[model samples]
Target: MDGATGFAVSALVNILLSLAGIALSWWVLQNVRLDLFLREPKGIQAKVLYILLSIIFGHGLASFLNDYMSWSQMLGSLFG
Candidate 1:
């Protein structure tokens, strides 16, 4: 697919993945005993860090997979 098509697909997939991640995180927080965010301070710094890290790890994984698959597809098109 072309770049635009790939971008559109990725955008849609990312939106869906984000919703799924939020739901999963909420479920885990409600049901699991991990207490992932309990230790975070109520200060603004902690809130900012939590938000940044969450975004990085959450969307970063999807972005990495998207880029990797694009490269793999490129290589396949070139060699196969």
Candidate 2:
């Protein structure tokens, strides 16, 4: 494959990996029973928004941490 094609493939793969993290985070938050985490909202819309934000932030943070861990491991392997 050409350089451009390889770069595109890598970008696509990264996007998919991040998306998978997001989906898993959303699924776990929605289905996992955690009473403390669920705050009672005054309205349906507010509740929905809260959950949506939570999922987005949770997934994004998880994805970041995952990437960081992978990088750290790679660095350790390179240096050790």
Candidate 3:
């Protein structure tokens, strides 16, 4: 692929990975008992907090995965 095409593909992959990460984070967070830590677990603020937490954790997870994938791909250069 040309540079432009490669870049586009990479961008798409990153977006998909980020979305998947966010979804996975949200799903996993659903099992947590927020009521133990929040005074108004059922309130709108709590819902907003949940969304923020999911994004934060999801971004972190996605970043880690992206870096790992990049590093693994770079490994091939060592033997080439």
Candidate 4:
């Protein structure tokens, strides 16, 4: 992808990842008992942390996916 296209794609990926993170964090907080092993912050603080965690994880996953996809494209271009 060209620079502009790649930038746009990355932006979209970040947005999706952020949303996924929020959803995942919310579900985990609601369904799991984290207080047993962690400090277990409550209220907005807790939610914020979870959301942040999700965003970070999501970003990492997206990065890996992007890398793999790029590698695949490179290989295809070379071999096909």
Candidate 5:
């Protein structure tokens, strides 16, 4: 494949991998509910917390997988 094609494939794969992380994070959040015991406006803070948790969980899991499996290099190779 050409360099541009390789980079495009690598970028697409990376995006999908992160999305898998988000999906997994969503599944876990659905299974585990967190109650902050706050009223309406204050409750928005709780929602924010949930959003942050999902982002953290998603990125954290993705980063861990790449590091553990040494797939980061493979992905880098695609770009190179």
Candidate 6:
């Protein structure tokens, strides 16, 4: 692929991965006892906190996956 096409594909993949990571994180977070940590677990603040935490964790997970993928792709050059 040309540089431009490669970049576009990479961008799409990154977006998809990040979204999947966020969804997965949100699903996983649902099982946690967030109520134990929050003084007003049933309030809007708790909901916002949950969303923020999901985003943070999801981004971290996505970043790690992206880095791992990038490193693996570079391995071809090392082996070539």
Question: Which has the greatest lDDT?
Answer: 6
**Candidate 1 wrongly placed segments (more than 4 Å):** 1-7, 17-40
Q: Tens digits of per-residue lDDT for model 6 on 17-55?
A: 999999999999999999998899999999998899899
In model 5, residue pairs whose N, Cα or C atoms come closer than 3 Å (at least 3 residues apart or on different chains), thus clashing, are none
The lDDT of model 4 is 0.70
Q: What is the C-alpha lDDT of each candidate?
A: 0.64, 0.69, 0.92, 0.70, 0.75, 0.94
| lDDT, candidate 5, at 11 | 76
* TM-score of each model, in listed order: 0.48, 0.49, 0.96, 0.59, 0.65, 0.96
Model with the higher TM-score, candidate 1 or 3? 3
Off by over 4 Å in 5: 36-42, 67-80
TM-score of candidate 5 relative to the true fold: 0.65
Cα RMSD of all models vs. native, in order, equals 4.8, 4.6, 0.7, 3.4, 5.0, 0.7
Candidate 2 CA-lDDT value: 0.69
Better candidate by lDDT, 1 or 2? 2
lDDT for each residue of candidate 2 in 1-80, tens digit (9 for 90 to 100): 99999779867766776677666766666655554554654557655765676668766876786688679979999989
Backbone clashes per model, in order?
0, 0, 0, 0, 0, 0
lDDT of 3 at 31: 95
> Clash pairs of candidate 6?
none
Residue pairs with backbone overlap in model 3? none
Model 6 off-target regions past 4 Å? none
